[model samples]
Target: MGRILLPALTLICLIAARYLADQVGINGLPAPVGEWIDPLRLSEAAIWLCMAWVAKRAIEVALRRGRNGSDEERIPSIAFDFLGVLLFLVAIIAIAGLVFDQPVSGLLATSGILTGVVAFAVRDLIADIFTGIALAIERPIRIGDWIQFDEGTPQRTGRVVEMNWRAVRMVTVQGRTIVFPNNALSRRDFVNLSLPERHFRTVKRIVVDFSVPAERAADIIMSAIRATPGVVPSQKPLVLIDELVERGTVFSFHFWVPDYPKMFMIERQVVENVLHFLDQAGYAPSYPKLEADIAWQSVSEIDASFDLPDLLHRVPLFSKLSEEERLNLAHQSKEVQARAGQALVAEGDAGESLFVVLAGLAAVHKSVEGKLCRIGQVEPGQVFGEMSFLTGEPRSATVIAEIDSVFVEVERGAMQAIVRENPEIIDQMGEIQASRMNAQEIGDSTDGTRELDDPGFAEKLVKRIRLTFGQPG
Candidate 1:
């Protein structure tokens, strides 16, 4: 606003001066002064030029507002600037024909040779500017969009940050800013990952041993990719045998993400989870052929450990259980797969079993002021429904699967038997439960609600547990 203030004020002053000169008959005042100035009509031309500048600034301001209205919408400033310059040229031509009574065609024709010489000398710069104008009009990509240039040995992907008459600037994943010449970009084909929509499918390839069945490998990898945190829940992930290689069978894992900028991070997470699941399934990647005899034990104790017992070990409430007890509990437990958006438990619903997340994400929502408000997220290795499991109470919050998730359900019978065998375990479990309650209390404090504190909450919880299980206090 400040930048345009001077130009606007100058225009107003020029108009007022011209009006006063006309009223006072200043055009006929003196011989030489009046004759020279009146014939050129310089005063009127100045007013026209000033008016054009003010109009251009106003148009640019409107363009800025339109660009800021949305994350995906963008309008290049250079396009408006070029239009403003063209406006100035038009105003100059109009003033020459109307005010000075000169022929506009002659003026333009006389400068044709000079324009040709300048164009020839700076042809590359002119091409860039014109290409930029074309791109600005077509708008294949916008600021903050992820785009790929498919010209090199390996394609380059980057987030566009700036665009102008000369170049388009973007920053790559490795944090390097590349200034792409507008003319070059215009000549080549590029892919806009953010166009059509932000969400798009991405794929990663893995090699598995030929000993592993193709269908089984695909199932395992698909599960792993679907359970990844950033995988779009609305789109189902896919896995297929892409090719057969000398080393093994090549499998392609396809998943969707909300945007392209985080593709690398999500791909890494998917790879890590896939490898973990593959290791747990006792299927490692194929090894290179060698002359020596290779002793490969495909089935190991680690593969056996991925059952309910392993998930129990991850929970702090069951961390103290002996391996034998864990195996016993595991025998009585069941592994369940939950589809994305499924509600596992609702607030105030009776549930005698607690679930431990083995993979994928879940969200905890509670009824607050008659509205379901998300309180927290439950990730892999975390536990939920324990409060209801321990005291035989109604569920305190609703747990919904944020993605395709796996969980191990520990039933009441198994828990009661383990607690009876290890009576002292009641106090340990109660303490952990109390700490969790206290954390919830702190979390709710911001909203003026308070829950039980840690001091006597554990003892009270232990008493409730004994009563719920029909055990002596």
Candidate 2:
């Protein structure tokens, strides 16, 4: 397609350019020595520039395809640039010879000193061009390579988007563009995160009270890392005891991720989970340094202090679980607080975490007659969003906090781990869900209300929940 289309456009531009030149009476055959400058040539140069661009694009597309068939298409883009330049010079010479009866080569020979002066003026630009060529040949970093440099301080990191004749363009993780001169990169040492695999391990160091057992802290980190969705399972997360600082014991947790762009997001999840786990496991960081660490954390990652295991015990489904099991659930749980009228889970919004009300009350509301009507009150120890969270379905009703509320949010990840450890809970969970659905306190007369007690319906719902949450039989 490119072969047929671009060349035809180039031909059209060539024709139009000649017709315009003829209309303006292109003559006055100025010799190279006679006209040190020619204003008339501006019209001709513009047309040739258009031709070169189109011709370069077409050649690039065609040659890339042709090369891919028989050989490794590692052909550098500079080759295409050279090819287009050669064609442009040929075209300019032919046009100049026809108009002024002197070729560009002859004109250049007469203007040797002028050409050398121009070359010296653009020496920096020429150096960049040559450096870019060498970089393309060396192939240290190709397009799409994630790299980090300026190791001294205020590091620059980004993915290489493109390499032009003079500079390398990179788009940073913080959504900023950085164009570095080729000579700059040629002299500096950069860490290519793309080599071998995109997966790279990042370390997060935390200082905890010295009283806390290192083994326990390491276990908590390992659990969080393994349960994290974006973490690469092939690379096991590691924990190292670096040193005991003035504050507390320093522990470094290393995690591997394949996608560099989502580093912050995945790290946020892991860090938040680690904090929760630490809090639940009766482990606390040294307050002086911990305060600073907490302040640096994103709003979404921060949580008010709460006893996660105790909250999990309040949930009827997890109430019967053993102390160890409850603690594990707590490690995987998120503590969420809601003010009055704040929706815990909204109708038609997809959910994975079951909100177990820990304090205050929430009103269960659903659309009735095109208006949200209060159905029932969810008090302490009661659960909402179980159906949607368990089944990976949209919330059937909106549960808004009637007053200030605290909730023990149990996500699918925690549920999966729970299932993996205790397979027998699947049946119990299904029965509890069915019983809750059939209870009359919730005023909805919809499918979730009426049909849940049906044995087949319960079985199907349980199966779906199991599958969606990655619960193995």
In the range 315-334, model 1's lDDT, one tens digit per residue, is 77787789998889989988
Model 2 quality (TM-score):
0.51
Q: Give the distance in Å from residue 151's predicted Cα in candidate 1 to where it truly belongs.
A: 6.4
TM-score of 1: 0.65
lDDT of 2 at 334: 74
| Superposed model 2: Cα runs more than 4 Å off | 3-59, 66-79, 90-111, 152-155, 288-473
TM-score of each: 0.65, 0.51
Candidate 2 clashes between residue pairs 3 or more apart in a chain or in different chains: none
Error of 1 at 341 (Å): 9.1
Writing each residue's lDDT as its tens digit, candidate 2 over 1-473 gives: 74658666766867787787789987535798436755356556656566676677777777777767332234555666767778888767766775456767768798899989989999888788888888777777777888888861223889888787878888887778889888877888988888767788888988876555555466556655655689988887788999977676798999998867777789999888777656544456765643433223332333334456776765656766788888888787776877767887778888777876554456788888889987776555557777666777778888887655566788877777777877767777776666666664441223345565566877776787678767763
Please list the C-alpha lDDT of all candidates, in the order they appear: 0.77, 0.70
Per-model root-mean-square deviation over C-alphas: 6.5, 15.6
